[model samples]
Target: MGEDRRKEIKYHLSEEKIDELLREAKDDRRKERLGFLKNLYYGDSIAEAADREGRSAATGGRWADAWNEGGLEGLMPSFGGGRPPKLDEDEQEQLVEMLREGQPWKSQEIRHLLKQEFDVEYHPDYLGKFLRELGLSYAKPRPKRPWRPENPEEILEERVDDALDEDDQPHNKRKGDDEEGWIVDDDICTDGGTVLGFFDASQPQPYDNSRRVWYVDDPHVERPLVKTEDSAVGFYAVNGTSVVQWKETEEKEQICEVLEAVREQNPGKRILLVLDKHGSHICEYTRKRAHQLGIDLVFLPSGSPHLNPIEQVWKYLKWTMAPIIVENEDEFHELVKDVFDQVTQRVSFAKSWCEKFLDFQKFP
Candidate 1:
């Protein structure tokens, strides 16, 4: 008989009731009713109820005892004061603002600030509890110099890039086992017999073959590229094909001609040309040539360079070539071409092209 009673208790709460409670408890009042209903319908032990409420068995037991002793009146909480606020309203607001701004303030920092400014010294544990109440947590970040000038440009960049590129990863699709396995190339083809080259190493294991892949959990490769150019007048394409063209120079005309050549090279291939929606790249002639070459020109959303493999190549080229001192444009062009030649020789660049096209097929 005792075993039978235990078995009945085990299956007391119907699965439907549990699901109904989960669905219906959208607000505090409904949650309270669900809690009470769970206790009533499930016939859970007073000790179990005590554990659920983080209270003593005596208190939990008393609720049932009260209901038995005086009916519905026993279930209500006595007009007892609720737990005191861990932080005042002002402190919570301040902490939330600081956290929103990516402030790396420690709990001790908050405590110290409170003590110094407001003459309130909260216990360290209590300070953490206060932060938790405000949905804040202690996180150590890179140090910032107190006296450093605030870079509005950096702040705007942060606003635009941080949301999408928080992980500082290069290639999101690359697998964990993928080392320095990919190669990238940047060759600028001009109509007038000119090719400017750019180069970057490739990440390995480009295809994510792992069965346990997750977008949030997976570590991304850190391809060094700026999401946005600092200057207003610059060149960008959907994939890291970015350059600050010398406005009104022969170089700009040459670049435009090279793009035209790219279209000419692949006459019938349904080319998906990804360009950064820069003003120069969006000129009337470029658009006309795109149609003429039968190129499906896709403009990338602003401030998203990670989507482009070419930009990664550009970043790699700049890093590698920064050491070389160029005397003039011709020298720069020669060094760039040499870098391009060196990069195209590697297999990673080909793999990147393959992976990039594959990704596009899936998403687009």
Candidate 2:
């Protein structure tokens, strides 16, 4: 009769319900028990299911008994029994406050501090678990310098007003239109020029590259070492449509050459050359030459690369070219040129890059 009772023991649940329970089970032990039950539902005997799940038949029978008594809740792994926390509520609060100060602290330092201040001790391995239980986490500390600007919102509003005022009196207004206080209504192309270009320079090194690949868990993934001896500086301009022109060199002369090429490309239109306050861009000779070539040099605010859209172009270029391997200086230069050519050929892409800075009102 006892053997018959053991053999007859069964709990029925719909396949859909069983699947839902399996999906909802968070712990692996619970999932394994659920798998055992699933095998039973599909006609496997208790012992057979237990063997498949690497558990004893008695253990499997106990799970079935629990399920019969309490349904899905019976399979849950209980967390009711564990060692009590060493730190009380007050001590935990103190630790949290100390961590919130953003000071650089390692587990060793924290452990020592706990011992010295609170008379508490925790094993190095268990410290992380203890912190997690208190809803605390380990993180890299970010350092920040004090920065207080006076009525920054008001300052920004005033700057916006100034830009709008400047916009009302467009830089390239027709002579009679300027006298008559007339404004061009079009935003597509300023009366000044159709092509709005942002200019910057970047150096592409041979060793700067990255790619994805699969690796085993035990061994750390490694990248091939490449010579970093050779690199090339590139001066580039993107009007947010296409690359107007790019020159290779770290020489200030290349800056002038790019400006001249832009001017020659768009013969009659005035080129508004937005660039950073690099020494090359700010030199008197460069400014004088720009003016002579019908180029208007608009310097971005100091330390504010966000204002220059060209920075995005340079970033995109570098990221796209990072995976290419180059063996020599010549190969490095050729790769840079090839990537730039590919980027500039996409007119729509270039235009989109310049879209954020298209609003003259956003400029300071």
Per-model TM-score versus the true fold: 0.37, 0.50
Extract clashing residue pairs from model 2.
209-322, 240-350, 240-351, 241-350, 241-351
Residue by residue across 205-269, what tens digits does model 1's lDDT show?
11223333246765553332312211112222232232332222333344465555554443333
Q: In terms of TM-score, which candidate is strongest?
A: 2
lDDT by residue (1-364, candidate 2, tens digit) is: 1242256544667878888988987877667878988887878777777668876554566566666766766654252346645774446667766765745678888899889988989999999987654445567865432342434334433433443344434433324332432322122233444455667776556555354535576433344455443323332445423343334453568777776666656565555666677887776656666655655566665554555555665677778776555566666667666777676554454464345335554432
Best by lDDT: 2
Model 2 scores worst on lDDT over the 10 consecutive residues at: 181-190
Q: Candidate 2 at 320: error in angstroms?
A: 3.6
Model 1 residue-pair collision total: 20
For each candidate, what is the lDDT? 0.43, 0.59
Off by over 4 Å in 1: 1-255, 326-328, 344-364
Model 1 TM-score is: 0.37
> Each candidate's root-mean-square deviation in Å?
18.0, 15.2
